[model samples]
Target: MPARSYLYVPGHRPDRVPKAAASAADAVIIDLEDAVPVAAKATARAAAAAALRAGSGGTPLWVRVNPGADDLAADLAAVVGPGLAGVWLPKAEPAALARLDDLLTGLERERGLPGGAVPVVALVETAAGVLHAEEVCRAPRVVRLGIGEADLAGELRVRPDPDRTELHGVRLQVVLACAATGLPAPVGPVETNVTDTDRLAHTTATLLRQGFRARTALHPRQVPVINAGFTATAEEVAAAEALLARVPADESTAVDPDGHFLDPAVLRTARETLDRG
Candidate 1:
């Protein structure tokens, strides 16, 4: 909900759930999909349900359910209840989202919860998911979109360079889809090497420039870097403040003392920068 940092705690590790919730992350996601082993999915589901009831400190708690029908049904049945902030649908596509919406509706009605109360964050990971990104973002109850880089890379057989240039287009596709649908900018993918703070920060900066307002954190240490990356720097804040002071709010166009052209779009960005700061 804060759109700064989303920390992931493996559902099978219930002990880590509270710890993650207490971290600096704006939200915590209990991963019941890739993070859980096939044999332990049931265990993970049960743990996720318990975590939901216990609460997520002050942050929102989301459960990332599996995409498969049987597994997803079990996942929703176990975790869709009080204290659950939303559902993160992995490998999300239009049809899968439709099914999820129906399932959630029935679950909420059966449990006496408010209809459409649960929001969904769709993670587009597969080739089909990426191709149908706009439709996925427009799906019912979908509040946000995210990319699953690892799965996506595997599907496309792309070995990106250190800068991840190969996936740039894919990332932009998700960003454009979110913009077109008027949803908040999509969440950036998690950087798997938790120990590499430098790479984490660099990639986070890249994501920020590419229209991502938040990123997923695989470890608590990654939270600070992500939070900082999304925030406006002092230099950025100063530039924004200067530009705003030079141009009136109602003015659509202006020229600064340095003769730099300022348009409505630039003014809007300045205001947004101040807000972020």
Candidate 2:
């Protein structure tokens, strides 16, 4: 999916799901993990499941299921059905994904959906998860990966770094994992500065430069900012289109006024730019 913005709606607040789905976000994730209190998880799961069944206003619907070993089964049972695009396995590790892949396969069949219909988006939020991200990327049914930096900071016992300087290696490792596994470039971590549009846009642009093609948003206002950050600019799209236009059908190279020799590699980049638009 070409999701530029993935908006998160708390499972406990089902009322927000429809609103979020209707927003400019390319996808909406119903969160049953960090957003909901432990005592309210069951109710939140039920609410989120109901919203999924109701439909997503043409937006893809994902569930960020609680991944604790004891509660994972319950979370899966409640949300694994029609309307679920995938699951966001939080604090995800390879062992959990392997188990989830098998269990999700069975659930898909039992629920009358095609096997592997519901893919996974692994959320890497720990130092261990960052180190072994490639393993998680290769896990069965995982389509893409996500950076949960807030939780990762908590795991590391470090304060959240607004500049994300502390996460430089972590982000690089996650990108390398996707590259190694042939998975799509993963979405970046959420930006907590929802109200500060300037900061939000800057952060999203910064992450995009760092190889994050998409980002999760805590609020709907952030969706458009993320989308704009990930989207190709009009000038960029025109340049890409022009570059591709100059390529002869027989050869995949184009030269500019500077006479720099362009190659098939540049052609691929141009196509990707157009695709992003």
Candidate 3:
């Protein structure tokens, strides 16, 4: 299944890393930017490197690095290694990502790693970055895109509303850019209201409908809800299966019992749903 939920853990909290890895989350992001204080960045990098070395097996493990910070070089040096899956470039700009691509390339070669060994995930958190999202998504090493809600709101001079009306346009733009590049749609910086699980699930469902394949969770309790929202529903799966079963073998098109037209594309989607289960 596509990774649909990413649990964010502060890199400085090494103890949390192991627990996060063992969670049901599809991916875990060891955050070194907003989650880590400046003085503790070095320590966070070291801890994150150790956690990566410990092994995530198959679960995607990514490290979020400060993009426009002076410590980025050192952050890259500490986090980019054989066991690390990818790097999340925060506050990423198109030109900056191009530079990051080069840096990652050189680092991989120097470390005797294969080309494109470490994919970069750009975090579009600024008006400038969102405006140039297409270029950023097309960067050589970029494999995914993300949104930083707080930073984006600040850049756009808007309040961080739970509904995120102001960000809807940029969010759609990011999704479009990702789709155009054949990359996973950007996920959301979901509301961190763990006590309000219903609201959390509702927010996640909204993003899922908008074509996002994943979402970030600050609290462990949010993981399962986010996963549930992103996963294919039983009703949807059943509908897909019913449609596929009605089609004759070797036939690419058919008419459903309801007189609706069915095409190969519909069958393909149905097959995919069952396969996912």
Candidate 4:
């Protein structure tokens, strides 16, 4: 899966799965947590499990299971079938991640699924999780991390700033932790103001500049904007190609004919941009 833009649909509403799959989203998240009510947990779990088994049109179906102790075992059991792409562990802490790793291992062996096949997206939403980001990233089968900023802001007592300056340090910590721990760049948090396309695009661009490669979306309309934000521009691709053409692969320390300095880091970045497309 491309994984640049993720669309989250309520798990209890299985009808919405096909619509989300048919959209331009790179991935679809079947949300059992946060979206589904407590009374509907059993129904949503069954619905999500069936959807996972059914599989959508070329779209990977992932489940956001409840992270609480009372629900974790049941939620994981309900959703750990053959077609589950992965699980999203919300409010991720080091201890919880370790416990999930063991549980997933057991479930995989019991179900005859490939061991380590089902990965986890650790949602580092709390101050404690942020402080333990490195340990969380180091946990087995942990693929990537995401920010649940709405919950985090409340925990940190941060006032909502349209400029998002308050979140800068937190985002940097996540990015650095991921880089140091060998995970792909963490997915950016969702933009809440979906109705304002201009604001969505602006926020996406801001996230991109801040080293976020992908983001989550609440609505279908935000998918295109999220994809566009993560993808390298046509001009950027062309420039990278031209740079590679001028410089030999073995020669990372070279200067271009147009007097541009080409260091190893710059060359590596060029290669990554071309690879991203």
Which of candidates 1 and 3 is the stronger one according to lDDT? 1
Positional deviation of residue 259's Cα in model 2 after best superposition, in angstroms: 2.0
Best by TM-score: 1
Q: For residue 2, what is the lDDT in candidate 1?
A: 48
Q: Which of the two, 2 or 4, has more lDDT? A: 4
User: What RMSD does each model have against the real structure?
Assistant: 1.2, 1.5, 2.0, 1.4
Best by lDDT: 1
Ranking by TM-score: 1, 4, 2, 3
Off by over 4 Å in 1: none
Error of 1 at 168 (Å): 0.3
Per-residue C-alpha lDDT of model 2 across residues 2-97, encoded as one tens digit per residue = 688899999999999999988999999999988999899989988988998899878999999877777888889998987888899998898889
User: Which residue pairs come into collision in candidate 4?
Assistant: none
User: Model 3: per-residue lDDT, tens digit, 146-189?
Assistant: 88888888878998577887778888999999989888667777
Q: Write the per-residue lDDT of candidate 1 for residues 118-200, one digit (tens) a residue.
A: 99999998899999999999899999998888889999999988888999999999999999989988999999899999999
Which prediction has more favorable TM-score, 1 or 4? Answer: 1
Clashing pairs in 3: none
User: What are the TM-scores, per candidate, against the unseen true structure?
Assistant: 0.97, 0.95, 0.92, 0.96
lDDT per model vs. reference: 0.92, 0.88, 0.84, 0.89
lDDT of 4 at 53: 80
How far off is model 2, as Cα RMSD?
Answer: 1.5
- The per-prediction tally of clashing pairs is 0, 0, 0, 0
Worst 10 residues of 4 by lDDT: 244-253
Q: Quick one: how many clashes does candidate 3 have?
A: 0
Clashes of 4: 0
Against the true structure, candidate 1 reaches a TM-score of 0.97
Q: Kindly report which residue pairs in candidate 2 clash with one another.
A: none
